[model samples]
Target chain A: MSKVRFGVIVFPGSNCDRDCYYVLKDLLQVKVDYIWHQEEKPKGFDCLILPGGFSYGDYLRCGAIARFSPVMEFVQDFAEQGGLVLGICNGFQILLECGLLPGAMLRNQGLKFVCQFIYVRVDNNQIPFTGAAQPGQVLQLPVKHNEGNYYVEEETLKEMKRRGQIVLRYSTKEGVVTREANPNGALDNIAGICNERKNVFGLMPHPENSSEPILGSQDGLLIFKSMLQYMEDGEFRYGGGEEFRYEEGREDDLDA
Target chain B: MKRVLVYVTPKKGILDPAGQATQRALQSLGYHEVEEVKIGKYIQLTIQDNNFSESSIKEMCSRLLANPVIEDYHYEVSDV
Candidate 1:
């Protein structure tokens, strides 16, 4: 099969850009390139990665300032055209800030920066991002962040649950969902979610950090493989995803 | 010159961990009577343009100064 081409975005303060590049190019042997935040071109890539880190030094909110980067416009356009987008940690924040994904992140419920290996249950395996895993599989991943507490209104939560938008949830290694297993008090234990269209995914855990066996887990590699598999299937092409408007998404209605 | 004061606060239903932590600290320091402490951002912008409008400032707050999803913002414009 042909290799999957991936583009990893690099905002000014994104420290994980190189890590993502290493995983895709060295580990997976896939064709990958770095797209600086100022550049608008995201041409001819099967997938895009918004790697984790303090974009804009987490100023004015973790992902707020970086969301306005020129490259995001193209990324937004790409996703609407049925391209796959994966956002990790700070990348998730930027996606939320840019309205590529729904909900907002708040400070960790304990008000401390949390850095540790945690297990997350894959709530849905039917979607492209988690398709390589079993429906209730638990994967070990590391999360390092200060603002990883995901918050969404109760009604939106219900709607997302119905659409299978809620894909990952913090859980015990045994795959039990409980408050004690939640590392960051995210509402509904949400560690990750996808847009209703299933093309854009954002997760707080750093899959790039734990993609190799030496990193103590190879489970992270499954996520990348899923993207590769989805691309190879060649199903979701130019016209499969739902219509997406560039204006702030579901969050706008919440202000009312 | 004109000054714009913008206040961005967590929305009514959103949890404010920072504010809650501060409140705990204050209460521990014997300010037990303090019922609540809500944290927010106070921004001061000095406009050199005479045409600076309140509507524009409001838009600024809505667009960048505050995230409408989990926060609310209000601004005041006055002569500096």
Candidate 2:
């Protein structure tokens, strides 16, 4: 089979460029390249990963300025053409700011920058990234962010659900990962989401951290594996896992 | 002329560890009467037309200014 080419974007303040670089090269055994955020566009690659880090010092707000980067124009164009893309943590925030994703991430409700390995359930395994995994599988992954809260309105949330855009959720206290397990306390306990087309995926958790047992657990490898499978199969398999439960009193919305 | 007041708040499901920590700080400062505190942003904008509608501004809130799901926004428009 031909090798898959992957690219990682490096913004001015991105700290995880190398980590993401090493993982895609060593673990996935794919051709990986680092494109600076200031570049005019993403080079030819089948997949793109936006690693997590504080971009532009998280100034103004998380990912506010990075969205306007020159590189993102190309990245957006790539995604619009059905290429696969993944954004982790701040990258996820940038994707939202760029309107590549549906929702927004706010400051941690606790108002603290949290850094730890949290367990998340793979809720939607039908996408190209998570398609091979079974629903309700819990994967312990590292999430480091001060602003990782996801917000969307009820109607839009419903649309995302109908479209199978939600891909992961927090693991419940009982060790089951489901949409209801919202570990970060996100809306629908969503840990990750994809665009309507499912080729663009964004999540706060760092699967690259858990790709190997020495690093943590191999739980996150499935995400990449699933993507590879999609490249081969051209289709995804779906199973309805836990029912989505939107927390009551989650009526809080933002306008500025 | 018209003006609109916009309020931004964190959605309920997301963790607000910072707000909770500040509330704890306020309690230890001898202000024991405070029950809860939520941090948010507020902005006021003036428009040239009185016909400026809430839906138009709400579009701005959803598209660029705010994330409506985790954050709730409330606005009051006044005609000058």
Candidate 3:
């Protein structure tokens, strides 16, 4: 199998960019590059990862300002072309701001920054990012954010649930989904979700921070391994090969 | 110069943990009359253009001043 190239977007104040780059390039042994936010054009890569950090110092909201960066235009186009995009932590907020993902993030319900390891259950294993795990499998990942509480309208939540777009949920170590297990008080204990096309995914946890056993937990490595496996199996093409029908009414109509 | 005063707040149905926490803190300080507290952002933009119109300001608010999904914004324009 050819090397799966990955691109890690680096925005101003993105502290996790190096972590993601290190995991993908060194740990995962993949071809990875860093794409700065100021770059108007994105380099050709199989997958793009938006690493976490206080982009723009969390000005005017977590990702409101960073979403307008020049490179986001290319990222939007890339996702529209069915390119795989994964957003972690503040990156998740950017995805929400850019309309690449549904829902919004609010201040954590506890009114404080949460920085600790939490368990999340794999809600859907069929997606390209979670194919390495089984449904209901529990993975321990670290989350460090003050505004990680996810919110969505009731109707949209139902539609996402129906479409299996809810990819991960905060859960207990035993894989039991319970309210008490939710660290950030996200709606329905949702820790992560993907777009209708399932090509874009956003989650608040820092998967890269836990990708190595030296970090005390390598469970998060499964996500990166799953992406490589998907690419190796010829499930995704780096450049556009087959034109996919862009689903209508799936652009996260927030007004509803 | 024209002064644009923008106020951005979370939507009504959305949870505001900061506001809630502040409200609780206030209540603990003996301000029991506080019915509700919603925290938000106040931004002031000074525009040098005399031709600034309400539509243009509204466009600015919609585009950058606020996020329609989670926030709503209103603005007041005055000559300065």
**Better model by lDDT, 2 or 3?**
3
DockQ (CA atoms), all models: 0.78, 0.34, 0.81
Docking class of 1: medium
Q: Is candidate 1 or candidate 2 better by DockQ?
A: 1
Candidate 2 lDDT over residue span B1-80, tens digit each: 99888887766755466677888999999888998877877878899894687789998777656655456778888887
Ordered by DockQ, highest first, the candidates read 3, 1, 2
lDDT of 2 by residue, A1-256 (tens): 3377778899989988788788778887778899988899556788888888899998756887899888998898999999999998888989988888987776666566778878776656767888767765777888888777678877889888777787777765455545434445577677899998889999999888788889867778888777777765656554344433445444422110
Each candidate structure's count of clashing pairs: 0, 21, 0
Give one digit per residue, the lDDT tens place, for model 3 in A188-235.
Answer: 889999999998999999889998888979988988888888878887
TM-scores for chain A, candidates in order? 0.91, 0.87, 0.91
Candidate 2 Cα errors over 4 Å, as ranges: A172-183, A234-256, B1-38, B41-80
N/CA/C clash count, model 2: 21
The candidate that achieves the highest TM-score relative to the unseen native structure: 1
What is candidate 1's lDDT per residue for B1-80, written digit by digit as tens?
A: 88988899999979998888899999999999988889999999999866787788877887788999999988777887
lDDT tens readout by residue for model 3, B1-80: 89999999999888988898888999999999998899999999898876778898898888888888889998888889
TM-score of each: 0.92, 0.76, 0.92
